[model samples]
Target: MRRTRAATTAAITLSLLAATACGGGSANGDGGSNSAPKELTYWASNQGPDIAADEATLAPELKKFEERTGIKVKLEVIPWPDLLGRILAATASGQGPDVLNIGNTWSASLQATGALLPWDGRNFDAIGGKDRFVASAIGSSGATGQDPAAVPLYSMSYALYYNKKMFREAGIEKPPATWDEMVTVGQRLSKDGKWALGAEGSNLANNIHQVFVLAKQHGADFFDAAGKPAFDGPATVDAVKQYVDLMAKDRIIAPGNAEYAQNQSLQDFAAGKTAMVLWQSAATSFKTHGMKEGDWGVAPVPVPAGGAPGTGRNTNSMVAGINMAVFRNTDNIDGSLAFVKFMTGDEEQRLLNKAYGSIPPVKAAQTDAAFASEDLTVLRETLSTSAAPLPQVPQESQFETTVGTAVKELFADAAAGRPVTTESVKAELTKAQQQMTS
Candidate 1:
């Protein structure tokens, strides 16, 4: 799930706390209607460059669904910043759409609310069985040893996107494979007015994603096996410091980026102001920004200097993607299931994933030629071999909120020329851990 700006964290936190306290009952009624409805509501995540672009891409497909199934889907493309808050509100008030798209990382958190329709044997059978999806995509769909709260829609993994022309001008032959090499290459590219890398410093989710991967490379886990936060651990502190050092100590990231809550970093790369960017499935977005197909190349995100990309400590990415979920109290359960089946069908999977520049989660659709591009090849390899899922615990959302904000503030200090020592990083992380325990 790509993020743009800071979410309404305070509101979401409060709503989530309330929902958890109440044990998450349905506000509408005891159950859904037995009969299918003629129309359904859907809240789509902003997968394209913007909401308008997503609308343009999905409208025709949705019309086709309506033509074939006689079910009109009322579509609303929700921006990332507002998507979580709106979903939380609806879960609490029982006023959400019939079907919605959720960031896959949030599956466990939302599942705890007891508001989403669980994909048990019956539900799985309705949508072509549970075996139709990729195992990696299925891993992040819900909590451990539980029926999934949602089904994977589009699969994605982070990769290093570099400008081919800039690399040639700088005499760099290939993308960096290790962090040391990245900093060395960055220093060489940081001359003149351009910087080596662009980043969304103030975006909460982006902050979490970067640090989470770095922590993994450092052999750290923010949460212990018992599901308690360990944010101030020695390895975790080192990971956070390393990521912020790209701007503070390495001087590879621009200082102005500390205030960039939106996708200004991507725009900077598109305009040739930055040499590279680490992003999730960004091809379609680049095209929308007027970057030609041959302008950029994709590679695995850099690993630790001596570490290789693989599972556990060498993981290079957090299993990233969007999942489709149904509200349990929706009046049109049958209609919602039909819509999900249509979206996850092989034909729609190929068409939609191709347009969005994402990998198809369906087992069969993934073999389509449209996804065999070099960019997707790298992402698919990373997803299968080096990606790790975020902690699938009920408190996962709180972890993202608290720790993500801590990193955001640390970036602000770095941009202001303050010392970002290991001690300072640990202190901030300690504060974040305290918020969860309190």
Candidate 2:
């Protein structure tokens, strides 16, 4: 749901017209409706291998809901690129789906606009209480100490993935426990044109998440207590420099990696050209690239050498995923709320996240036998014990772009064989910080 850039005019215009024409009325300001609703409109995020696949997976769930509630849902699975613009247009035009999917990172920004209903006591009770969700998942649903504006629907976090065959060949008995150890293992594994680490250098959101994890491990935050941009501090600069050094100084990253995005990195890992990658929801893509379950192993990302002992190894991963919200403008409050509850129910969480290869948000689903696999267990533990939410600021989307672009530029310079020093990273981060505040 975190697309790097804006949408085209045609896409915006077409979606706007559809939203206005169909949804331009009775945005549920009052709790009461003029009449009982027969059906509700739902905007689903693209979570399957394809749109059709998602529809197929959810068809039974929707049918069951209609049968039980006597209210139907008309579902539209929006692609990630168009979702934000469509939601914005709907907000401006007083038109949008009754219930929709939003990336958890956008919760605070959308809440600031007051376009989505806050999950007060009534709504929280409807969806099984706050206790039913993972604490980290609920934490990311809105601003700290405030009523959540959305409910966690799917959960994900970055974990280290290593090729088991490569590890055995290199005589590495276990994955690296710290970043310094990783560098050593990577150096030993790199031989005859094969590198040890692969990353999505051009994936803006992915890069931002990576840098956030690194910065947190080194005791840094992207914003100060006063809410100003704080991307150029000592720890932040060190984090970016170390990430860039994977290619420039360590030389364990693939050459020409600046052009590679998420898919390319996975492809490299699956092809045995790289030994390690940090990823979330990698099972499907890992298979698509011809890797079987037994071929790769998953572990928590390594911490800095001198960080806190037990928890630091996994503490820094951003508690990021997707959430579901109800539009304030919708007249079908009852139907919309009902659908939200149904979607977060035990059955639906398992069905949807299983298809998406993401962890379920519900605590019950986390313990279900469906999620008992080793990789899922590690991810569940990470979410429970270590994951931290992205800073819940209205300027978060801007932070993603500005900081991501700076890191992207660093990657570009490194790919071109320029010397990437800590000072150079600090300068780019300072510029990014300026852009965020301005």
Q: Top TM-score: which candidate number?
A: 1
Against the true structure, what is each candidate's TM-score? 0.94, 0.87
Over 236-334, each residue of candidate 2 has an lDDT whose tens digit, in order, gives 999899998988898888667787864678888889899998887677668766889899998888887765323443475788799999877576777
Query: lDDT per prediction?
Result: 0.88, 0.78
Please identify model 1 stretches exceeding 4 Å from their true place: 1-31, 34-36
Pairs of residues at least 3 apart in sequence or in different chains that clash in candidate 2: 27-329
Give the lowest summed-lDDT range of ten residues in model 1.
1-10
lDDT of 2: 0.78
